[model samples]
Target: MGETTQHFVLLLLCLSGLVHSSAAFVFWTAVVDISYYNNITNDTEENFCECGVYGQNARVETTSGIVVLPRDDPKGCHPDTVYNWTSSPWIALVKRGSCNFSEKIIAAVEQGASGVVVYNADGTGNSTSHMSHPEAAGVVAIMIGNIQGMEIVKLVNNGTDVYMTIDVGSPHGPWITSYWLYFLSLAFFIVTTASIAYFVFISANRLYNLRMHKRSERKLRSEAKKAIGRLQVRNLKRDDEITNSEAHMCAVCIEAYKVGDVVTVLTCDHIFHKACIEPWLLERRTCPMCKCDILKALGVEEESKDSITTTLPQDATVITVAGGDSLFEVPLTEPVRSDPERQQHRYDNRAFEGDTEGRE
Candidate 1:
């Protein structure tokens, strides 16, 4: 989870950086000059910083005097705002608002205005923003603060001609526009949030499965204990054995049963030393010789079908417990009965009944 969060933060930062670099504003410098008192007032002059240039307006050069548009044009586009190719190049000055920036720039374009200057709305300070006028390609456009635009507007309205100059200025900031900043912030936030959410969901699922697996193991162990309890147990005796003809070994340890040797017998009539088979049955609940689940055979409720990972014969020593494919088959034989009625069951015990039936 920590690693995931770190990666998300890095990705978000990269996105923010991309938006900041790609969406930048170009700064423009406007030199305003006004002839006052017939050049006797030293000709008032001021330099103003301009911002918010359209992409098409970047790096544009304008070397003409300025012209202010009529205040009450029907299209908010004064006839004077348009430039004539035959005349000297001119820059048109206009107030902001009453329509979109694109519309205003388009109106100026029809009149041949080589460049456009839009001032801020009434009483708004000189703060400026970038202009996106897709239709105003090939035209230079810049915005000046309201205070500066109004000062220039007053001089032009009073019939005082103001000479203007527009030029590319110094580069600025890592964050060029507010809209880009907002957009990047929003995108970063969304991606990071989603990544975190997914991480949490996966973690929760794994924990849930782990708990369920442990619970299942416990239930399997409990059922096996009950099944093992129902199996038959006996002690072999030397005196009860018939004259030595052949020897039989315990299937589990490959050792011969002796007097006082305790052993267990499964329902399938397979026998194994008690200590050996008891542990195995308590875990698996299946006969080692035939792979039959004693629990299910006895009609006990089960969680599911047998889920052992390995396939092996049940209730027999033929199956290797060490995770190998090798099998060792035990020899089948007939039982020697000292008595008739129960003699049949004695044969399956792999030896004559010994130790007087039940001394242990």
Candidate 2:
């Protein structure tokens, strides 16, 4: 797959994992309803509230039983704690402290309790948190506020029987109740849009560059054809110097010239068979022997003079005197005269003199 496709697939996998983890954090709220006989009014009184959260591993179902507190250790943290109630359907009420929620829930489950209610710690007026009790599964477990638990504990202590019903309420998760969900969604949208835009830009730039390169190549080939037509062509005769000698040969075909053969001469004065050199010049646009560009030589194409400068070796140019005697050498660009009394300047001064006369 392409790199973009791989990145999109990876992004989808991360989104799927995030959704699954968010679902795991989701938990159900509990609706706790308690009813008891009020001795002052001689009537049955009922109080209900959806202020409870179920444990992570607990069964999310309805269960009703008589509320029962531990006779010893109200937190129900002890392994040997017992309940005085002798009933088949009894809910254990324990304070939140001293141990994990699993220990308290397991203690009640072992004692024939159908459900467990754990209250929040002291000073936490009516706030309850979701409990995690993986070791105590299958049983209905919920956590209520501290003030609510104290009211039921006081009723049971006053010899009043309290019947409690626990029912599953609404589900709550981080995505539903947290502000970070909006921030994450916005960030993901911005990243996805920027990636798509960048990919499109890169593809368009590559296509544009390729088209420009091909257009330039076709234009250069057309100009080379024009330059070839302007070169010198000749028909060899029997008495020609090339046909009479065996030393000269066509560079393209590597064959000696014969009488009545047609040939073309390039700007560098290198001659080759017309048929052989035409195709070679069309492709390379340069002489095979001297590497001379026909387009620049015939004025078919203009090139920068500064960019076409010749480079020479570090050694100076050697000069030969009239009698074949050696004399001082001088650099080509900057010539220096060794003797001020010389008869005439040995180096050619026509180029410099012409520039001076033109200015005058």
Candidate 3:
């Protein structure tokens, strides 16, 4: 589950990078202005002019008079033609042709025209195009809808003067520079910073847990060493020295303790081979039979870096009951002497009241 969450975070970061670095472009638009007086209406009204920059240098303030060289000839070019431009600036209106856009613009340049407007072919309606005439520089050029061009043409044929204006329109560019780009940058920064912080948090948490585990192990080992040192380790005595009944079989290894065999006595008074219980104490820190912490039984506990001592009453009594033996109490008035290196201990107040005289 942790690994899945981590992968999800990584995937989000990748997506953010892709979105932040993506590219965007803007298209050019033409602004055409046209106006003429209508004899029937007896009023001069401006015509709706929607133009697109078709070629280079399309920045004419105004152009008037007739539109000439209007059709593409056999060579797919609108050849030069003379126009009576002494009254007003000449605006050349041409049709879409098979020849390159530059060829048509060059033809108009030869005819002394001030600007050029290229309308669409017969089948295409008012669809405008962006035409770049790099070959004919400083010559204002633009494209208009076929329907619009035809309207102006009819007006001109009627012998009415039509005036028009042209210039470069609004600009467009990369998406990153747009308004929404700011929002994207903000979100990207927030998510990226959060991811970095989360990564650092995870690293610090893991390190802390590791250090705590190592400290716990060291603490347990320290207690184990103390308990092992205090414990009695010696060779098993002969039958005459120590009674055979006290040398019971080890519950851990399930083996009897033979004379001369090396062994250790636990705080519970239970005995086992020294080798067997040391590893068990280090791992489990408990007696095999009673399942009690030997460290606790030995009165040696690791509370913290500093030792905590608890005082108990000095005068006490030990009571015990054995099978086939009567119950009795033994008084204990001795204040245990504290060893310099070991923690103060309270001697156990339990003793076995066995029938010592009935043994023989």
Each candidate: what lDDT?
0.58, 0.75, 0.59
The candidate, 2 or 3, that scores higher on TM-score is 2
Who wins the TM-score comparison? Answer: 2
Worst 10 residues of 3 by lDDT: 348-357
What is the C-alpha lDDT profile of model 2 across 265-348, one tens digit per residue?
Answer: 777556779999899887667665445667888888633222333453443344322211323232222222345234124432
Q: Write down the TM-score for model 1.
A: 0.40
Where does candidate 2 stray beyond 4 Å? Answer: 1-18, 177-360
User: Model 2: which residue pairs collide?
Assistant: none
Candidate 3 lDDT by residue in tens digits, 313-351: 664444332322333322222333355122212322121
Taking all chains together, each candidate's TM-score versus the true structure is 0.40, 0.45, 0.39
Cα error, candidate 1, residue 266 (Å) = 1.1
Q: Runs in model 3 with CA error above 4 Å?
A: 1-177, 238-249, 254-256, 304-360
Model 2: lDDT equals 0.75
Residue 328, model 1: Cα distance from true site in angstroms: 4.9
lDDT score of residue 111 within candidate 2: 91
- Give lDDT tens digits, candidate 1, residues 20-130: 453344333444333333355665655544444433343344445555554455224543543323454666777788777677777776666667778778777877776
lDDT of 3: 0.59
